[model samples]
Target: MSLPKVRSTTVLGVFHNGEVALGADGQASMGNTIAKSNVKKIRKLQDGKIVTGFAGSTADAFTLLEKFEEKLGAYAHNMKRAAIELAKDWRKDRYLHKLEAMMVVANKSELLIISGTGDVLEPDMGIAAIGSGSMYAQAAATALKKHAPHLSAEEIVREGLNIAADICVFTNHNLIVEKPV
Candidate 1:
């Protein structure tokens, strides 16, 4: 009765020494089937100044990402304003309201998660994550961040996503990482 959604990515974000990195595994699946093994979920916008990772139905996620890019342009590339505007429109617009996607977005100074419910949230510890394997990735990132202060943001993100891929059936080790720098 529902869409054959592929909300299977494990996108993870981490911060270290004022730098932020975001990464996601390359697996996409629907139900018991692996739809794809190397889908690139990470995107760079604003000339690599903004990095985004998404999870959900692939087409829906692409639509939301495009809308988000438009919002960023309308807001003069201000990450916070664009995120809030995207959330507002996504929640209010009937077409967008039904989108089954979530995104983790980052700029050099901020990391945020935006949802279809009109929520734009910043993690308390400079970490953000989304998608089916988020809890596993987030937990691993948190642990790595706390205990491995020397690790780079990208290192933390990579390790976290790797851990998620090990545990989550929907996630795989083909990772793509990006940083806003």
Candidate 2:
């Protein structure tokens, strides 16, 4: 028997005010075919203090997230340090290096973006997005920031998700969302 294939796109964003949000389309594809369209890609951890969004191989993303969660658990009271440590570990871990996935994470004080390049990126504007619809989501978010600076972080997230949903059948309102405390 052959192994199952998975394809899904995830989106994540963070506002300058330290508010963070994550969104994903429900679609998972297998070998040029649509498999599941309503899968959740955003996860909440550390009693709602941490949020993570994943893109790429679902299993790989889960594995990375598990490692991140463990690190978070170890440093619950120190989110920034925890994030740095997790990103550093993710960048260097041999197993993680082979996985084809991207993740955006946020804790109380900062936002971190990680990808297959083994780079830990923190945008100057304090925002980032990952996955297939990331570009679309990023454009929407940038527009929101320029045209509607007063919008709350949650509102920005909703707008980004709506834009993504319009273009990708895999993403919808039921898309999972997680925010920071």
Candidate 3:
């Protein structure tokens, strides 16, 4: 029996200018093939207080998002605790551990990456990116944030994703940006 195919995309998140924003390119790919565009890979959680961006298997990501929501509720809307709880479960649960996905989660105060490897990481520079275009987007955002102190968080993420789309074939122009008001 042939195994089901998994899809992936790019996700970026940053904290800048006293704001936190997350962005994602809306392109999905399967084995070098473009499957779809305009996908919403970034989301708001905890009554719109936290923003999360995800990469890797779409199905797995959706499941993780649900699980994360539950965790958030369990932790009383604490972003860090919920992320850590999700990571612990993701790593320890045999079935969940096998799911392929990564997440960048943020609030006005923090930016973090939760991995299947049981890691909940807070980026040193308060910026994080994941997926195929992650390296390119991260580098671009880092440079921009350092050089362009006047840019808003949304602007930095938009430009970062644009740069990633230029370099990564799996990334596209359909972008979604979310931040807390």
By descending TM-score, how would the candidates be arranged?
Answer: 1, 3, 2
Best of the candidates, TM-score: 1
- Model 3 C-alpha lDDT per residue in residues 1-181, reported as the tens digit of each score: 7754557677888899899889999998877788888788988886678888899999999899999999999998888999999999998999999989999988888999999999999987878999999998999999999999899989999999999999999899899999965
> Regarding TM-score, does 2 or 3 come out ahead?
3
Candidate 3 off by > 4 Å? 1-4
lDDT of 3: 0.90
Tens-digit per-residue lDDT, 1-181, candidate 1: 9967665888998877899999999999988789899999999998899999999888889999999999888988999999999999999999999889999999999999999999999997888989889999999989998999999999999999999999999899999999997
RMSD of each: 1.2, 2.4, 1.2
TM-score of 2: 0.85
Task: Give the poorly placed runs of model 1, Cα more than 4 Å off.
Answer: 1-3
> Could you estimate the TM-score for every candidate?
0.97, 0.85, 0.96
Query: Which candidate wins on lDDT?
Result: 1
What residue runs in model 2 are displaced by over 4 Å at the alpha carbon? 1-4, 16-18, 169-173
Looking at candidate 3, the ten consecutive residues that score lowest on lDDT are 1-10
lDDT (10s digit) by residue, model 2, range 10-66: 475756455666666666777667787788888877777777788889999998888
